[model samples]
Target: MLYIIDILGTIAFAISGALVAFDKRMDVFGIFIIAFVTAVGGGTLRDLLIGHTPVGWMNDLTYTYVIIVSTIFAIGFRSKLNYLRTSLLLFDAIGIGLYTLIGLEKGVELHLHPILCIALGTMTACFGGVIRDILCNEIPVVFRRETIYATCCILGGVMYFALGVLPLDHNIVFLASGTIIIATRLLAVRFKIALPNIYRD
Candidate 1:
């Protein structure tokens, strides 16, 4: 199941990147490049930060192929996505939920301090989109105080570790953690809930 969740997250981010490329009127290659970056950027950063040499996609082509296929499929079926209005945000939330667990578990395996593990988890869930926005010449959403983007991951990470001592099944913990991350994002958007704007004054 972890593998499946990872792939679904990959596909979601890939679609989001492709959609951004399409919005920017980029060519097919540009779309593919952005999609690939968005799909693997955060995980690669987490691996590097944790001293996992060569990173994940470097040794395995599975993620690469998934990104490629997802980009193509997203571009081909994009008209339907247009009608959804919030497709990009939705996909991004799903990506965050899945990637957080992957990073958290990797940190746990490396025996890092629990708080740093939570930081790693938040980075894994958000840094990809940060890179994506930077490359696309947009402000990184997580850097905005009013967005409540990465905070969802941070709060969800806290929840994950909080639940760790509860005697629940590990898989249940994982699912609940991911759900918390995703739900926070979705609900925040739904209610326009966000941190106070720093520049409002």
Candidate 2:
């Protein structure tokens, strides 16, 4: 189940990255680069911070293959997908949720503090999009005047930790966390909810 979630998250991120590239009218090589970075950027950062060598994607070729296949699919379906903004948001929300839980799980496995684990989870879920936006020459949506993005990951991570103490199945914890994050994001979008921004007068 964890493996399935990881693959789905990777594919979602890859598609989002490819979409960004397509929007920018980038070349094929550029599209692949964007897709690869978006798929692995967050996980790679988490691994590096946790002192895991070779990172996640570098240690496993399956991750690389998944990203490649995902990129191809995104490119092939670009025309059809152009009209599905909501579907793309759903995929992105799922990716964020899964990545958050995966990072938190890894941190817990390493015996890290819960607070630190939550931070790691948030970073793992958000930094990929940050890198993708930077490469695409756009301000990251997470940092802009938009609905809560990283906040959803943070809240989900906290919920996961809180639920971990319960006599619940591990999979249930993950599902709950993912569901909370995705639902929050969707609701935020639906209601145009947003956090207050700091601005210089």
Best by lDDT: 2
For candidate 2, lDDT tens digit of each residue in 62-161?
Answer: 9889988988888888998777677777878888888998888899999999999998899899998889999999999789888898999999999998
TM-score of 1: 0.90
TM-score of 2: 0.91
lDDT of 1: 0.85
lDDT of 2: 0.88
Which digits, one per residue and each the tens of the lDDT, describe model 1 over residues 17-41?
8887888889999999999888898
My TM-score estimates for the predictions, one after another, are 0.90, 0.91
Model 2: colliding residue pairs: none
Give RMSD (Å) of candidate 2 vs. truth: 1.9
Candidate 2: where are CA atoms >4 Å away?
Answer: 198-201
The 0-to-1 C-alpha lDDT of every candidate, in the order given, reads: 0.85, 0.88
Residue 138 of model 2, lDDT score: 97
Error of 2 at 162 (Å): 1.7
- Badly placed stretches (over 4 Å) of model 1 are 84-91
